[model samples]
Target chain A: LAKTTQPISMDSYEGQEVNITCSHNNIATNDYITWYQQFPSQGPRFIIQGYKTKVTNEVASLFIPADRKSSTLSLPRVSLSDTAVYYCLVVENDMRFGAGTRLTVKP
Target chain B: GAGVSQSPSNKVTEKGKDVELRCDPISGHTALYWYRQSLGQGLEFLIYFQGNSAPDKSGLPSDRFSAERTGGSVSTLTIQRTQQEDSAVYLCASSLTPRGGPSYEQYFGPGTRLTVT
Candidate 1:
């Protein structure tokens, strides 16, 4: 199991690409980096997951280096609805979500 | 087409009373998880179930907290003798089981808000 660290908050303008990074120095083998989004008053939902390199989906993109020590979640053209808490999860034996980075998309 | 669903969107119970929260996972999903979130706090994993395997209860706060996934679709989380500290939002998620384990993209339901007085 690995502990993750992410920024507490981030501010971005609409139409901007927002990237939030998480560090997990102790990431173990077979671990996967997963990102989740949680809107206010709702449960958290998975947005994306990756093992290494880059993985992109309709909602977001994830980038991981060969070292596998950190990963970044990229949200392109973020809108007001994209404002929420973004959780970075490193799943090895079990899944654990960090405190997450609260992203605020401003007009 | 339907996402995960939970019942009793809001529950208010007195201290020492027991409460049961229900979760209905998406059809065909083989994995389900339960979590709790307090005011301004991050989610705390409680338990999870995968197919016919025994549930992972390592995250349960205490013996009073138990959960069961019946027929591998619907899950019920029971909190015995609820206390004021148990007030929080209970969230449920389900995912299509991946090759290694339940690490695939998960769909979530609107959480149930619990207020214990």
Candidate 2:
């Protein structure tokens, strides 16, 4: 498992775009970058995943640089309901979660 | 379709007691995982079961913690001699498969909140 580092917290307003970055300097070749969102009293939900380059889905977009040392999660037109804790994980088999980045979407 | 379901959403027990938490994974999912989440903290992996293969128990914190998946569909995490430090939310997740790839997306249950007094 690769250790990940992310901001402790972030703040944004409604209808704004929020981007959270995660750093995994020692990522392995087989490791994939996955993002999950967790709301109050709920389990984390998968948002997006990527091995390299960029991957986009109905909810969010994941951008992995060429070096694969870091990745970014882009959320467009965020709303108050988007407030949650975002986790960036680099996993091969075992999934180890870090403290995560808390995004507070204000109204 | 149901994602994942856990039983006994909340449990309060005394120290030195034993407790069991159950998890029902999505139909046909081959990979099931157990995790522990403390208040204001991140998730800690506990155990994993993939199909009929031997479960990976390396993440278990102690001998008191044990889990078993029967028929590859349901799982139960048992803790013996629970202590106050065992008070936390226990979560269960399932995925289509356990292969290390981008397609492995884990669906989590609401979790069981255990409070050991």
Candidate 3:
């Protein structure tokens, strides 16, 4: 598992596109970049994952650069319900979490 | 279609007492994991079980903390002589297989909140 660094918090108004960037300079070749969303009093939910380039799903998008040292999660048309903690992880078989970026979508 | 489930959503015990927490992984899932999260803190990996065997128990905080999985489906985490520091939310997750598999995305349980007095 590779360690990741991300912003402590971010704020956006409803209807805005929000992008949270994470840095994992020591990523391994087999490591995959994955993201999760967590709300208060609930377990984390898987959002998206990618090895390289870009991967998109109904919930969000993950963009991994060519170097694979960093990645970004793009959330489109944010709403008040989208407010939650976003976590970025680089892992192969192990699971670890950092102080995720808390996104606050204000009305 | 059910996800991982945990028993005793909350537990409160004295410092010298023992407590047990249970987790039921998703059906047919071969991998299970246990993690603890303190208030406003990142999750701390405690153990991992592949099938019925636990290959990684290094994350267990101390000797007093132990876990076992039977039938590769249900797991129990037991804590003896609980201390106040042991208070935290214990979570469980399971995937069809470990990472690198076609469907390794983990599904998590709501977690058991333990409060040791």
Candidate 4:
């Protein structure tokens, strides 16, 4: 399992774009980068996933470099309800969670 | 027509007693997983079950914590002689399959909050 490192917390104003980056220096070739959002007292929800380059969805966008050592999750036009803990995981069937980035969207 | 479901959304038990947490996965999902989440903490993998075969119990914290999946659908996580440290949210997730093919997302249940006093 690849260990992930991300900021403990980030603050952004409403309507602003937010980007959370995760570093996984030991990422394997077979690993896939996945991002999940979790709110208080709720389960984590899958936001987006990508293997390389850029993958965009209605919710968020994932940017993976060619080295695959790190990835970034971009949330466009953030709202107050978008405040939550964002987790970046390098997955390969084995599940391991790092301390996720707590994103706080201010109004 | 349904997502994963867990019963007894909350449980408060006394130390040295036993407790059982249940999880009902989505129909036809062949892979199930159990994880523990402490207050303000990340998920801790407990076990994984695929189909009717034996589960991968390597993530179990101790011998006191055990889980079983029946008929490849529902699962029960049992904690014997529970300790105060067992207080946390027990979450259950299910995926389409665990093999190395194209992977589907893992859907999670609301989880059962266990408090051992």
Evaluated at residue A22, the lDDT of candidate 4 is 96
Which residue window of length 10 is worst by lDDT in model 2 chain B? B97-106
Q: Mind giving the per-residue lDDT tens digits that candidate 2 earns over A41-82?
A: 999999989999999999999999999999999999999999
Sort the predicted structures by DockQ, highest score first. Answer: 2, 3, 4, 1
Instruction: List clashing residue pairs in candidate 1.
Output: none
Instruction: Report the lDDT tens digits of candidate 3 across residue range B1-117.
Output: 888999999999999899999999999998888999899887888998887554588789999999999877899999999999999999998888675533358789999999999
Q: Please name the candidate that would achieve the greatest TM-score relative to the true structure.
A: 2
User: lDDT, candidate 2, residue B45?
Assistant: 93
The models' CA-based lDDT, in order, is: 0.90, 0.95, 0.89, 0.89
**Candidate 4 residues B1-117, lDDT tens each?**
899999889999999999999999999999999999999888898999988777888899999999988888999999999999999999999988673333457788999999999
State how far residue B68 of model 4 sits from its true place (Å): 0.2
Q: What is the TM-score of chain A in candidate 2?
A: 0.97
Model 1 lDDT tens row, B32-93: 99999998788999998989988889999999999999988999999999999999999998
| Model 4 ranges with Cα > 4 A deviation | B99-103
For model 2 the TM-score comes to 0.98
Estimate the overall C-alpha local distance difference test score of candidate 1.
0.90
lDDT of each residue in A1-107, candidate 1, tens digit only: 68999999999999999999999999888788888888999988779889999999899999999999999999999998899999998876576776899999999
**lDDT per residue, candidate 2, B29-103, as tens digits?**
999999999999999999999999999998999999999999989999999999999999999999997857868
Global lDDT of model 4: 0.89
Which ranges of candidate 2 are over 4 A from the true structure? none
